[model samples]
Target: MLNKVLIIGRLTSDPTLRYLPSGTKVVEFGLAYNRRYTVGEQQREESHFFDVKAYGKMAEGLGARLSKGYMVIVEGRLVQDRWTDKDGKAQSRVRILAESIRVINKPRTEEAPEELSEEIPSEEVPPEGPFDMEDEIPF
Candidate 1:
């Protein structure tokens, strides 16, 4: 069987990082995906929240940079966790174990409204330059 999942959403809060007894790094966070649909003659919207986790390098990177309202794309698989409660009843939780994540939105800057700086000028490269393709095997 093959299992895979991909989701893009905004983070609900900052990621929490922890370490297991085995010294494995783990990061957990929540994501919110909005859904839009049409009902009768009006437009309706809703959000689906999901719990996510990353391990090792992925976990460490996300825990260091991700924050609330940041958009991210995650690729992973569904994982189910079970544990016994104080009363001896079993509880189960479903989450996504992230294999990779790409940040889509950056955190807001701390600068004041009038402190924003204009973007620096970048060197412009001219495209469509003439080149010979047959003699270009450099590798």
Candidate 2:
């Protein structure tokens, strides 16, 4: 069985970070994604919302770096939390358990430099150089 999910979306609100009784770090946030489609010569847009969670180091990092309106790419798996409600009814909802996350864009703010909004982290960027067929492929 395979349970993998990948999504790119904007954060709906600032991430909330917490720690479990065992001292495990956790973060939770909401993500919104937009979908565009054409129907009968008309263009329509739809939005989807999802609850996302991350654990440990990933959770701590994301909690500090992410904010409302930040665009991010999340890779993880689907998780369904099940429990009993107050009325003795069974309830369940699905959410993403993020394994990794990457910030693609940051929301414009007065305190931030304009150029920094779209800049990718130096470590994730490839070195600039002319392509050479003779060079061995890093991959």
Candidate 3:
């Protein structure tokens, strides 16, 4: 049996980055996913929130750049933790242990294209020439 999950959604808020006692970096974020379905007569939509966590370098880079409304793709496994609450009730939460994350889309803005230009010899552009097809039938 395989246990894996993939999700594509927008960040609900900026990722929070923290470190453990041994300085192990961890980042936590929530994703807002929406799905549309048709009911008996009308169309309906619902939004779901998923908790995600990234570790080490992935956590550091993702935490710095990810912000609210950013779209991302996450792949990971499921993890659940159980604990007792103040009411003497057992509470459990399932979170994702993200193995990898990739940005899916960028919001529209007036930003220039990122050009990675390298120094190269510039050649003169060739002049345009008119096409001549007079030979016979000028259709």
Candidate 4:
């Protein structure tokens, strides 16, 4: 069986970081994704909101970096929490248990400082010159 999910979305609000009694770090945040589609000559846009959680080093790292309106890529699995409410009715909701997160863009706020909005390097660009077989690759 395979249980994996990948989503690219913007943060709905600042991340909340906390620690359990055992001192394990945990971070929770809300993510919003937009979907656009055309149906019978009409265009429609839909937005989805999700609750995301991360643990340990990843959670600690994101706790300091993530904020409202920051675009990010979340890779993780789905989790469902089930319980009975005060009304004696069962309640459940699904959320993402983030294993990894990548910030793809800065926050939309104009007041963000240039340094704070600096792009996080995603991948190293190859050299401009043509590759030479004899040249050693810097792996």
Ranking of all predicted structures according to TM-score, beginning with the best and ending with the worst: 2, 4, 1, 3
Best by TM-score: 2
TM-score of each: 0.74, 0.78, 0.73, 0.76
Number of clashes found in candidate 4: 0
CA lDDT scores, all candidates in order: 0.68, 0.73, 0.68, 0.73
Model 3, 23-138: lDDT tens per residue?
66667899989999999999999999999876677778777766887777787777665556777787777877787787866433488433322211212211223211221111
**lDDT measured at residue 2 in model 2 versus the true structure, 0 to 100:** 81
- Which runs in model 1 stand beyond 4 Å of their true positions? 107-139
Tens digit per residue, CA lDDT, model 1, 1-139: 5567799898899999887666767678999999999999999999999999776767777777778877778777776666567777778777777767877666455753222222212222112223123211111
Tens-digit lDDT string for candidate 4 (1-139): 6778899999999999987665667678999999999999999999999999777777777878778988888878787666567777888778787867878777766675343333222222222334324322221
Predicted structure with the largest lDDT when compared to the true one: 4
- Pairs of residues at least 3 apart in sequence or in different chains that clash in candidate 4: none
Candidate 2 global lDDT: 0.73
* Clashing residue pairs, backbone N/CA/C < 3 A, model 1: none
Question: RMSD of model 3, in Å?
Answer: 24.0
Clashing residue pair totals per candidate (backbone < 3 A): 0, 0, 0, 0
**3 Cα displacement, candidate 4 (Å):** 0.8
